[model samples]
Target: MQQAINKVELRNLQIEDYKELKNSMVEAYSELKEAYWQEEQIERLLEIFPEGQLVILVDGRVVGSALSLIVDNRKASATHTYEKITGNYTFSTHDPFGDVLYGIDVFIHPDYRGLRLGRRLYDARKEICEKLNLQSIIFAGRIPRYAEHAKEMTPKQYIEKVRAKEIHDPVLSFQLSNDFHVIKVMKNYLEGDVSSQEYAVLLEWNNIYYEKHQQLINTRKSVIRLGLIQWQMRPLNNLEALFEQAEFFIDAVSGYASDFAMFPELFIAPLMADYNHLSEADAIRELARYTDSIRKKFQEFAISYNINIITGSMPLLENGNLYNVGFLCKRDGTSEMYSKIHITPNEVFYWGMKGGSQIKTFDTDCGKIGIMICYDVEFPELSRLLADEGMDILFVPFLTDTQNGYTRVRNCAQARAIENECYVAIAGCVGNLPKVNNMDIQFAQAAVFTPSDFAFPTNGIKAEATPNTEMTLIVDVDVDLLKELHEHGSVRTMKDRRKDLYQIKKLKS
Candidate 1:
């Protein structure tokens, strides 16, 4: 095999590299007096917590090192000295179950000053923190070279200058660039230290990848605003007229500052201009023909308005087969389709349409969501599967001709929300189109729902438009509150699921 040309590698420190490590430390910190760690201390650190000790090598030569130890943040105070915190460099305060990773030291050889080896060491420490599920990494970063400008400004003034990009301190500047924020300045942190003027700055980097058992709470802009439109039946006109109407509603919702705008199932029913002249089967096929053009327009609106839009559901034609599909258009003009997985009897007998075979969830900036059409929301298994896969919200677009038909979809939607502990929003078509044959009549009411828990609304209805009316409703749903309900609700529906007795697995694709 050819010798690997990659010169740099990171690995755990070994017991045999103490001599080289001592020499490297001396070469890296040559300007400081007595800065090298003792051989016994290095050996002890490797013996007790070898995983926390990392070494950087260039062609098998140890050129840099980073050491860390876990410490309980509760026991640490705002003004503790370095010697008191680390137990005189022995790290006797290391707690295995602690939530914070304390940085002991980091140094690179003089030859590796501009190679960014220190940044590599810091990234390695972050990787360790994530793997261990640590909350954050805290360190007493030095203001090295501050002694050169100590008489010119105080420590606070120096930090402000470094933050404002007016002046730079070697260690503090590097830490700030690496996403570390200064917490406070520690007095008498290191005795007799010329660098930092014997004062060290406490800094922290939160491990965002860490998974905590507690629910996540958001303090800033926690709600996702949704605009649901209950479209009224209109005459079958040209495609341009239909598109203009959709843009009208989308523009209206955008003015209200909605994050996501949703329409009803088959909201494009009025665009089927040639339906009355053809048979029922031909009419359904005609609807599929407009899928591509409508999809492009929907994406354009999403990008132009800078709002995410769901095209309730469209009649799509795929490889000579007709399917009821919905297009989710993101703010960047990207889109994905979700075909209705449960076919109704009317669709099967009259239109010869088949049900979709696959189910999927979409991740958005608002939240993780699953889209279901009219009849799909009536099935418990589909929504439960989506909830199990970490769906926090479910969107349903329905079309019903009678009050009884509307009640079925609305009741089942509420049941799914309660059972899954997920937010459910339903939008539907209203009014009647007498000349449109099968789509002549519609009775609907748009509603946003939530779980019937203390954390959520009491009756599970957040907002609802009147039945048999043309209207739009904009409501806010909190994703963080859904997380809270999943973990600590009055009745934990997700957690209380009896998985031991029954397992519902998705069929192989």
Candidate 2:
């Protein structure tokens, strides 16, 4: 018997398997009053969606089968009856360009009931839904055992008991275990479902990777790769030396096909060595003079290396007032700027830096992203605002003078990732520049963080570099996982917010 079971294989339904398919369906539904599907009906299903009709065979004998069709969810209401969805078994409602996959039937022969054949067919249907980029899989699931408890409870109560594991329902329990949820309790869903007393539950399984628009060839990526440079601070003889060092790391990261490359905040502070003879405030203002030329150079590198470049944070002198700013250079030859919204006491006293008034997320080819400089990430309100704008990843380019400072930024960034249900990456400068005042020593540990859930790492850290080292941390994160967490995670922070009682509003600038 084990040897025979070893021959089990799944494939598309064929014409020659109709006889076994019909026999299996009759056997599986013997307790029900409905008749099995006819050969003509099976052929019509194949004509509509050939790949959706799946079968499992053991020792060349058909034992289980599943049938499905596509339908526009907007037209096929959740309250729709099975007959309406199937077009009275003619499948006239099947839409080739539909966003939802509708399950018609699934059955397994009694002889193969203990082999878990039905699960194989269900898994196959989910695979097809994701591959086709369907929004969800919807079906009217039967409560075959509901008649036993109909005298004492309602269908809703029965479903609740089944969900809580207090009751054992063959179909409902199995569906619940497979990550499907009841959308609604439907009545008169099937013509002769006597065991369920013509009652059924509408079930749905969402495809997390679903996108609104359909493309013959999808160019947008669901997984984005990141490269973070743990830069080392050192004196540079000229601006040309800085460009050469930047290109070396850019070329290395782009070689690995990274989508974005990030540098530490104030990474170009070494250039301040030329003006170190002046006061701290005077030298930083002089450092601001190089911002424009450096931004242009990074933009050229972004286009040449085919990677988005986050130019850390530089001194920006505007109208005689200094501001800490960062630039996002896209591979398409476009550039965007974000200013630090919060100023540290040290920055204010030494450089007389003023805070920027705006905070927003940036649109990138990979996805929506947010940038927060060293001190900006320490404040949760700024990140929460970006989260409202649908930020997928938060990049923190920091320059910490001590391990305590780095710890503050690290812990806060991790909290932002969990609270916002997004990814957070931190890159910072290490080593030292003794000649440059206020930049003498640095501490850093670059890391990528994810939401704490089953789909992510147990500790929530995707990858982290060695402490105070000059190296790159490369990691890939799936944006689809964020979609799942927003809707179905064990702890759904975004969905469970008490907006009725309190809300976070973005005030006008």
Candidate 3:
């Protein structure tokens, strides 16, 4: 297998490999520098990585292994935490969407030392990312001496005590050797003891510094029906076949006067439940190929239908890391793209990519709009950011199952619209998807959620498709009303703020 070189094959380790990997990790780290680490604690690490990507080498007779966990560079997400740390608020409803990566836990075997195996394993993980095409790889480093890797070290700490994790862990050294840059020092998120403080070092590897757009746009409201489609039960094994299924479903309502449409997270790829049996690296690479093909199809669909179609979440190969990104195209062939900002824990654990840069709202002939995929809308900071930046209609595209989730999200959409006084539209999938592990716990049915301003049921159900069915919701957005509401109420949330007065401090070196 190409995965194995120098008598070493980088195969994804399974539950069976957990014991060996953990032992190897403890031996290697302990030998380098003694530390107190439990077998169960290491076991939790195994659980965190589950079965994603691994490298196993056969040196002479013994087999050695290494594993990598894909963590998000979600540095500076908790503005609420900042208020507590800095003794003042950092969030003024002005800005949000943190661009940080916590690429942690790259474990290797002790017996596998010498022969530059450590660098080889690091390069291999990076190579896997390159083969698949992703955005960036961020990892967390220990503090103190690692302060060189942190956002900042407080004056008090600078004069006295040293931070432990930043100084003790070898991740900082490992990442620096790999050309990863330290972006910030995370403050007060992870909890341990007060004596040995823990601070997350945001490290990133990217050619382009992904940026956020905070500019507002002018929009008008009109009636429009939109559909969020999720065709479940498929852990998509074949890209061609999956795309065909999606094409068939969308083609059914192509000629209708629908203004827009969407799909849910992993909309174009497979959803494997069990990590132990899969190599997410390969899966992500495969999904990238599918995204390229599907995006072109989506553009063609927009041109043919003479509408603005919003393509749902797909793995976007930016550089070497695959990002959960969405695409928007108009009939004229022009396009806009939005990368997901707030990622779920599972997503970060599975893929080594960060969310988007900013809360960008695009101004189009159709309307002044913005989009937040699935979990993105769950963060209040993001909602406040969009409103602060002046967006009219926010589109939430999702793939949800379980009535509880549907209700929570559906109600949340309305709440945001009421608070922001803008328009809200959602597209969802309704079906039973086979889990990579459970194969049960199917998703809820699909529907379109609209805001209250549109007469009765203020939560407008323009034209919601039935859950567990193949369909599209079509309606016109009243961009004018959205503009009117924003001018009067929704836009007032940020009328007062003092940016320079508050110090946005992170637990520093």
Q: Tell me the tens digit of each residue's lDDT in model 2 across 1-509.
A: 24355588999999789999988888889986556889999899888899999999998989889999999997555587888889988999999999999888888888888788888999899999999989999888999989999999999999999999999989999998877888889999888888998899888898878888866673678899999999999889988999999999999999999999999999999999999999999999999989999999999999999999999999999998899999999999999999999999999988899999888899999989999998999898899889989999999999999999999999999999999999999999999899998889999999999999999999999999999989999999999889878877999998788989988877855
Per-candidate Cα lDDT values, in order, are 0.86, 0.92, 0.56
lDDT of 3 by residue, 208-297 (tens): 312243225532224554545555555555656666777665665556656666666555545343332656665565556667677888
Report the C-alpha displacement of residue 494, candidate 2, in angstroms.
5.0
Clashes of each: 0, 0, 61
| Per-residue lDDT over 1-509 for candidate 1, one digit per residue giving the tens place of the 0 to 100 score | 11443678889998788888888999987877878889888888887788999999888888889988888876553568888888888889888888888898899888767778899999889989988988889989888878888999988889999999888777889999887888888878888777778989999988765556544563224588999998987985688888888999999999999988999999888866567688767897998888899899999999999998999987877888889998999997799988999989988887888888888888786768899999999999999999989897899999999999899999999999999988899999998787666788899999988999887778999989988788889998987687667655778888887889987889855
- Full ranking by TM-score: 2, 1, 3
lDDT of 3 at 209: 18
Off by over 4 Å in 1: 1-221
Against the hidden reference, what TM-scores do the models get? 0.61, 0.85, 0.48
In model 1, residue pairs whose N, Cα or C atoms come closer than 3 Å (at least 3 residues apart or on different chains), thus clashing, are none
Indicate the residue-level lDDT of 478 in model 1: 85
Query: Which regions of candidate 2 fall more than 4 Å away from where they truly are?
Result: 1-8, 57-63, 109-116, 144-169, 181-186, 214-218, 237-241, 318-321, 384-388, 415-421, 451-461, 480-509
Q: How far is candidate 2 from the true structure (C-alpha RMSD, Å)?
A: 3.7
Best by lDDT: 2
